[model samples]
Target chain A: MAKRFSAEKYVAGILAGDRVMLSRAITLVESKLHSDHELAQEVISQVLPHAGNSVRIGITGVPGVGKSTFIEAFGIYLIQQQQKKLAVLAIDPTSQRSGGSILGDKTRMDTLATNPQAFIRPSPAGKSLGGVTRSTRESIILCEAAGFDTIFVETVGVGQSETAVHAMVDFFLLLMLAGAGDELQGIKRGIMEMADAIAITKADGSNKDKAKVARAEYQNALHLYPRAASGWLPHVSTCSALQQQTGLNTIWQTISEYLQLTRSNGYFEQKRRDQNLQWMYEAIRQGLEEHFYNHQQVKAQLPDVAAQVKEGKKSAFAAASELLGLV
Target chain B: MAKRFSAEKYVAGILAGDRVMLSRAITLVESKLHSDHELAQEVISQVLPHAGNSVRIGITGVPGVGKSTFIEAFGIYLIQQQQKKLAVLAIDPTSQRSGGSILGDKTRMDTLATNPQAFIRPSPAGKSLGGVTRSTRESIILCEAAGFDTIFVETVGVGQSETAVHAMVDFFLLLMLAGAGDELQGIKRGIMEMADAIAITKADGSNKDKAKVARAEYQNALHLYPRAASGWLPHVSTCSALQQQTGLNTIWQTISEYLQLTRSNGYFEQKRRDQNLQWMYEAIRQGLEEHFYNHQQVKAQLPDVAAQVKEGKKSAFAAASELLGLV
Candidate 1:
């Protein structure tokens, strides 16, 4: 709907760190129109040379876990203390009603929203009949090309979105509440083990002792897990954005130490390289499956076939073959 | 390669619980020849009507976790105490070397291997250039149709195979070694959460106290995880396949309780149905990717394209588009 621009202009603007043009280009990337898609691809290819400069971190917690406040504190700390320009994006597939998220992303945290060093975008409502077509991975590239040295991909921890977030980010940060009562709150089955670090949010007041105990428990629990592929051990820390942002510096230091160790061992670059190939294969799989499932014949027959397979009237492989045969 | 029989005969033999015919059918399913594949499909379809009657359980542990001994004890226990016919199959993709596993699965478990009420099959060595082409899933169907009351899919703990076994089974049993030093020994990242029950193996002699402590610790750890989708809490127990088979009776009792609870609440059938649909989709994805990657044009260009993408010389999506275009 906005004025169209040439791919070269968009590429130059993003590589030169022009925020206005970068925002407009992201809109183009998120656009569902066919022409817009072509323009976005062209821009992406041109800017690919300048991307991959930022550290991509994925943050997640249950809704009540003070995610917005933690992000605000963390983002501000990065800007003021670390001198890093930060871009925060989200991968919420369920956010189909785009307007609410736009308002929430911009206004959820007061200081970070207006900070020149922070570029915050809500989850893109690219919910087409097919699916969310505007990939968060592409958005990460766009932000990196725009000269953001730090990137955060925030996802609600209760859904499958964390897996997508995990695949794209270099380090995953999981926020949790202290105490066992909240164990069932705001997390999925395999997510806790995926964390590069666990930060117990709201670790002030009466909860401070509880938070410390929780940290020790979680650390022991995480230690029981086998080593992560990167050879970095996941630790648990206690922090409260509400109370002087305690333990914030430790979080940053831990990350810096991880960066130093992984970079020294060459896992940082190796992981990124492997991630690139992984995403390529993932994209191919997603594209092929989308094409198959969205075919007219499949759209009509899937429900009946699924029901039959579910009811044990037909076998899974046979039904799958029937669908593939139609394709 | 041997004489092929009619699908009708194979199906009849399988449904009639003929062990010789069942072994031959499983052999046919494992055959890599093209004609064998078609016949396997026919036999699978014909037996589909009688499949899904057996209680499928997945058992996993590291090499040192007494998996073979535990399975032997458990298998014999089921045969003599519970009067259940059991079939054991494995999903070791690396079992192509085959010698070590044969020694472990057969010779290491002398009594169970000789037990008339049990059928044991080693992992297929169909590790052709394509990798693990003979599916254990098809073998599961053939075994089930052969009137086995209990099915166990055993997997080496520290690999991708556990996820495959987890997907097909109704209950997942993970074996763990006692002591904090062995914390990283048998456990993988998310495998603990996937377990319906965890048995601390080798819990006899001096390790008994440690195993009991471990049982409590693991029980607490398992409790900290969010409930599995099935709504059944994961239980932790201490078992010594070596001594008195002390906890073996409890394992059976736990499984019996699970079966009673789930069968009554309808989650059992619902989960099986869900598993069927999930596997169908997974099979489709695997098939589609296999077809694409195996294409002559795609194969020729894939390595160069993959290297380029991995080296950051090309965008992943763009490289994917190039390869997909070839396909």
Candidate 2:
């Protein structure tokens, strides 16, 4: 019965900048309460015409890396300047055993929660990529429909292997702490090679000196990375969320300069096209994974074949072919 | 046809402890050249009863972390003790981009390759976890059939996700370098928590002091982790692979003690059983993933739904159900 709601009505509300409706639409989409996914797609179709104006930023770091604090401070800065309507979407990577998230970022970012100009949503990172939630890219569309010009997609740092988030965001910012010896060793060259910007968080008080040293190291490393397709050199800087001022102006200025250069050269459009292709590929891969695991015939035979394979009585290839009836 | 290889003949040669025929059989199994995986499995089944006598050890660390150097020194130590049968397998994670490896371990471990008692195989990771070749587990079984009592699975420590090697090995060792500041920050909690032993590599010369300090830091961190199922504490030590004699004895001693304690208490048998179960689970997951992605109908419709979701024209969940025929 709930699935019968008009998708067009919700999408119209979203396009008209109704926040409550947008929130409800995203909830319906993210929920596994039932497969209301198809109906939600109809609503999305009505809302697509209004998206694409927002700058999508992806933020990631390990737990307790002050991701929430950073987002709250950054969100407030954008709202205060009345530069753009801002939204913060944090995807928490949960423990597989407990199926519960380690942190609920909204609870930690109280100031941002109360600000009308800022919309903050915390999502459990289900079975999707490490950085973005299942409905994140969709949620971004809704936010854009509701007139949000900047969207922050924050993820619990997954160490290396974060290509998923990189594929979806316009700017990928890596947050780190100072005194992390030989910056190159702490985070591998592969990860550093992907960052558009690296910000040393907790740059206040005793960590200030360490932050300065880290900044210098990162600056040197950035020089080693090939120039981004956007034709802008990756930048590194320090920021202190506690003081509510940590060279955010410099960050904004740098980003603006990057966007200006890329947009003028048509690189921004090409990037969006590339992102669309990437998302399509991930969607197909994920969709197939869901199908194969959920098939009735395969599910029934899995346990028996698994037992044989586990006991070393059968090989994996033979077992796999049998499971799919290719034998 | 290549699928008509004689399993009886291969089994006869293997039980007689003929390493030449055993190596040939393994080569047939690892070959993707023949479109038949069935013939290889048949040969493997005949040899299965003679397997499981080897102590499977997994060693991993980041690239440039001296993994090959350590394996060379360790493998040589086993051979000198007249344990002449030592097998080394290094799984390359970069194989997907580069069609096949150059198999360069000989250059890296010149001494060990010259030892008659030792056999080393460098395998491409392909799409497998830990960048391990698909046949690695099977290869270990074949190595045991050839009378090799100690098998080492070495993988490039790309990130925290290389836990696949741990699932198949009797003992899991993580290699680290010293002076990795805040020592805690340098080690990812995911990988560190799973390690059974933490060995600080490159511990000679100026690096020795840093190694000692890192050992102390890791010792404190190890205390926080629960004891192993065998009631053994995770060990922290230092090693210099280039020194050849630095820490190989400690590693062997630790594994021996673990096996002794667990064997008497029946924990070792149970642990092996659990590993079998884990392997089955991984197989099922991988099989299902392949099925879903390879399904013709599912592939054809997924992109349209994805595009709709991207444009905010459809909710991902709703679109998925419709494509899956649930709606």
By DockQ thresholds, what CAPRI class is model 2?
incorrect
Residue A290 in candidate 1 has what lDDT? 72
In the range B118-142, model 1's lDDT, one tens digit per residue, is: 9988765446422342367778888
Q: After superposition, how far is residue A243 of candidate 2 from its true place, in Å?
A: 2.9
Assess the local accuracy of residue A67 in candidate 2 as a C-alpha lDDT between 0 and 100.
74
For model 2 the local lDDT of residue B57 reads 86
Residue range A143-177, candidate 2, lDDT tens digits: 98899999988765654335566676788888787
Q: What TM-score between 0 and 1 does chain B of candidate 1 receive?
A: 0.93
Among incorrect, acceptable, medium and high, the docking class of model 1 is medium
Share of native C-alpha contacts between chains A and B (below 8 angstroms) recovered by candidate 2: 0.20
lDDT of 2 at B131: 21
The Cα error of candidate 2 at residue A254, in Å, is 4.9
Q: TM-score of chain A for candidate 1?
A: 0.91
